[model samples]
Target: MIGVIATMTVQDGNGPQFEAVAAELIEKVRAQEDGNLLYQLTRSKADANVYKFMELYRDADALRAHGTSDYFRESFGKLGALLAGEPQIEYLDGV
Candidate 1:
């Protein structure tokens, strides 16, 4: 299994938009990706504009496939404009 953690900072006043877009992304993956083990988008209680994601895939191929997915390309392209800064991502293994 592979785990991924990501932190995203939504643009000022764009939190709601980000949430809506992210929700759509979640639904897309859930409906289409068979190798997905876990996927979640979380907002920080202490920081209104900060969001995070926890994702798990079966293996490296699953992870790589997600990158080429239509939802990923479309969502990331749109989400980038709504973010305040570059998203931080970390990969985990041997867990």
Candidate 2:
């Protein structure tokens, strides 16, 4: 399995738009991706503009597929405009 944790900082006043885009992307991923074990979006209580994505995939191929998906590309393009800075991403392997 593969795990990924991505942290995103949204620009001020862009949280709502970011969340809306994220919601749609999540829905598409859940409905279309068979190898996605889990995909969750979380908001920080201490910082409303900070968000985290918890993702689990079946394998490396699955992870690659998710990254290359048209939905992901499109959503990310939309998300870029709302971000305060580049996202921080971490990839992990199961112990």
Total clashing residue pairs per candidate? Answer: 0, 0
- Give per-residue CA lDDT, model 1, range 1-95, as digits (tens): 99999899987899999999999999998888898888899999999999999999999998888989988999999899999899999999837
**Each prediction's TM-score against the native?**
0.95, 0.97
**Against the true structure, whose lDDT is highest?**
2
Clashing pairs in 1: none
Worst 10 residues of 2 by lDDT: 86-95
Error of 1 at 64 (Å): 0.8
- State candidate 2's TM-score: 0.97
Question: What is the C-alpha lDDT profile of model 2 across 1-95, one tens digit per residue?
Answer: 99999999999999999999999999999998899999999999999999999999999999999999999999999998899999999999966
Q: Rate the local accuracy (lDDT) of all candidates.
A: 0.91, 0.95
Angstrom error at residue 5, model 1: 0.7
lDDT of candidate 1 at residue 31, scale 0 to 100 = 87
Q: Per-residue error at 49 for model 2, in Å?
A: 0.7
